[model samples]
Target: MSEPSLQHPLTGKRILVTQADAFMGPVLCEVLEEQGATVIASREDIADPDAPRRIVDQAGSVDILVANLAVPAPSSRVGDVSAGEWRDTFATMVDPLPRLMQAVLPGMREQGHGRVLVMGSASALRGMKRASTYSAARGAQMAWTQSVGVELAPENIQVNLIAQNFVDNPTYFPPEIQENPRFQERLKREVPLGRLVSAREDAQFAAYLCSDAASCFVGQVFPVCGGWVNR
Candidate 1:
């Protein structure tokens, strides 16, 4: 069957997406633009101290903010993890998310409308053997997203988390993980669909959640796991 044409229910809206250089980020930007929304794509690493200011300077008025940058954790046991490694992982995966949201919240409040999509991982729901730090950070992100969503609901600024499964995008998976045969077999066996989720599929859902159609969904962690969690 021919694919359906991309359509945006949020046409004419202004959207800002961080980590635009990432695979999913660009896909989202293109989809939003095709749907009639004015998209401001930023390649900023939100973990950087100066990133928030740079994004604000570039996208003057952001009606939607998608925080989608994450640093992969180095494989190590809890006891063997170094202090610097822990700090770096926390900064990249946990910090900056709230800071970025704070930068855009005032303007959204003024307009009485906004949508914040925070990308998390399915690993947060299920523990991975060597990914303790990464899982913890994602769990924290989901909790933070919920709190912010509740706080901003009165102002019509909805915040939600997308807990993604093993998406079949190079950017989503670290090269080292992809190179591991045992991990690959585990993923194939665990995921009910027997395959990785597609970037386009996740992007499509994100586009909808950021639209008026999903106005009622707030502070919720929506899973796009392809039945991985169930197994």
Candidate 2:
């Protein structure tokens, strides 16, 4: 089948997307390019020690910044979690968002206009059983994005988040979980949509959030959950 086209409202804009090789990231890139936006792709693991420098080198100034890198926590009861696991999860999902935001803000402020979209999960809305770390980190990201949005609004920069639901992207589900029929059945029952959200749909929402049309949508955690969170 032919690849789907990206129709973006970001014409002539410069967009920087982190974790470009990941499923949603590439789709977003394609869409932005289709809309005439110049996209610079970066794959620095945001949790890595040199992530800031790496991202800066690849992206000097951007009209839009999409922070889309995250590490999903393993599903386990709270009592069964280990320190290292918790640290790793936080490193990817929570810690680096602020740092990356700092790195991008100076240029954005100088320009007096910018758009920032931080990717989050619908899991943050309702805590899932055996997903303590994931819930905590995603929740933190949502809050931080809102705080930044408020702080940056006076400068004409918009900051928001997309609290996505059960997307069908491969990265959304770990291999073992995808291979488990029992778990899959349970997921089907839990999501009222009766299926997972598509990556393209999520990407399209993201692209819109980064466009001029979303200028008034600051500090909001918009859901693209396909009715999952509403239930």
Top TM-score hit: 1
Clash numbers, per candidate: 0, 0
Worst 10 residues of 1 by lDDT: 1-10
lDDT of 1 by residue, 1-231 (tens): 222244547676888888787747777887777777788988877778778777876799888988876775577888887888778877876787877887888888888898989877777888778877778888888899889889888888899989987775556575787778987887778877866777788888888888888899889999886676354
Candidate 2 whole-model C-alpha lDDT, 0 to 1: 0.79
Task: Provide the lDDT at 22 for model 1.
Answer: 73
Q: Which residue pairs of candidate 1 clash?
A: none
Q: How high a TM-score does candidate 1 get?
A: 0.90
Off by over 4 Å in 2: 1-8, 174-184, 229-231
Please list the residue runs of candidate 1 whose C-alpha ends up more than 4 Å from where it truly belongs after superposition. Answer: 1-6, 174-184, 229-231
Native-to-model Cα distance after best TM-score fit, residue 15 in candidate 1, in Å = 1.0
